[model samples]
Target: MASQKPRILQDTRDMSWSLIPLVLLCLIIAGVASQCSFSPGGPSAGPVPTFDIDAGLEYDAKELGFPIRHPEAPEGWQANSGSRSIITGEEGGDSSTVGFITPAGRYVRFTQSDAGEAELVRFVAGESRTATDTREIDGRDWVVYGEEDAEPLWVADFGDVRILIGGSGDEAELTTFATAVGEAQPLEP
Candidate 1:
């Protein structure tokens, strides 16, 4: 043999070449991470998911065997989410809920169900809440609960059904929504 490289040196050179791709990948990831930014705090503004209120109401009414009211959203209000579920408890029944984003960027949830007042309040608000006051909106009496908190819960009984409206909305926003719900017509099953 004319000249032979040491086996250790040859292995070291091969290992260095194998590490080149991993080094480049690490550098690329660092560059991308350095260019990224995040919000300091608070909720980020983004497109909200849209919910079909009419279709939801129709489906709930037919499936639940109860009238589901279709509230006309206030100007600039958008229905962002909705769902149908059974209220579990001694007074369990079918429940339909729709969440709205108010014009002021606050949230309001409307729940309609055949569940009793206590069950509805517990389900929509919380078990720790208490009835604080009652307000008449659009000729309907709404029992207010947890009014001292940022988001208060309001419930209205309509014979066989109960409607609960609550969320981060203020009194004005809640009133506007309650009025809308009060004026709404039940969807045809």
Candidate 2:
């Protein structure tokens, strides 16, 4: 019985050794799965949203009682999300926001809000002060704000409606988006 102990131990060690490769294979599979990103369609987890910027703009225009502007983005620039946002509380109003993936792979959002002048500047540019510089796009005057090194927030108001163009960009990229929004209007479907 005493001598059987060595034989039993040897059998156990052999069994453990046999399982080592299987364990390593399982670990390898886990590692690969962890690194794998399952973006089924595109940016989102599920099927990527094919945001209809024109349709959203049309709806917002009707709802806001104003012609909400939208961009006719160049090739490779796709709209990721587009919706109308309603401001809550006493300052109740609506805004249209469309998130876009720029051709340069940068994110830029075009927001047209019915907020007050101060609120429009504050909401987009945060605490940043408006720059003295300005630009004209498609016959519309746009006021520029934000640091020189960062993406500047451009604002232009038509009566009670305030249009803000901002997001990841330098002056050039910001200008590009502003131009697109100013020049283009969503055609009827």
Candidate 3:
């Protein structure tokens, strides 16, 4: 008996293997073209700072001095266990939220607002007074405040910036927590 002959279509399969390189070459060319079109340092570069925030604390806002007192918590704000007593300032004119930070990682935050002003003053003054500036760090715009012997606070214009006032700890821990909180991204405003 004669051996069967191979079909033409069947033979094409073996040669198809060679086409793989051609396909890869096309992909490479496309990738290179796309990359070339991208420009570095273009306008609208997101705001970011030029320094490493994770490093030691720097003084800028620190000169402003520490907050005179912890503002009072807003109405309906519940105090966490071990939370210290908060002093509420005048209502309407100044409006304040009072709360305490315990050394045991307990904090009570009260939010109140009247006459259009929210409970923001206490939030801003509760911690170290830092000089704030708009800066671009890692492709994002942050309102960064520099404090002496304290970590800089980076405020994003996202949601209303909330300041972390107290949680019982040494000076170093407080500084670290403030810095970490500053680096976080707030809700988009």
lDDT of 1 by residue, 1-189 (tens): 739667756886688998999998988887788964556896578997899887888888888866789988999999999988888889879899999998888999999999988888878765757788999997899999875545788999877789999999988999988998899888777
Give the distance in Å from residue 188's predicted Cα in candidate 1 to where it truly belongs. Answer: 0.7
Clashes of 2: 0
* Tens-place lDDT digits, model 2, residues 32-141: 88954556677643434568876777777777755566557867778889866665434446777888776666777788887765666665565637566789977889
Q: What does the lDDT read for residue 1 in candidate 3?
A: 62
Error of 3 at 46 (Å): 41
Best-fitting candidate, scored by TM-score: 1
Error of 1 at 59 (Å): 1.0
Once fitted onto the true fold, the runs of candidate 2 whose alpha carbons sit more than 4 angstroms away are 1-49, 88-92, 148-150, 185-189
Give the range of the ten consecutive residues with the poorest summed lDDT in model 2: 41-50
True-vs-predicted CA distance for residue 37, candidate 3, Å: 68
Ordering by lDDT: 1, 2, 3
Residue 21 of model 3 has an lDDT of 87
**All candidates in order of TM-score, best leading:** 1, 2, 3
Clashes of 3: 27
Q: How many residue pairs clash in each candidate?
A: 0, 0, 27
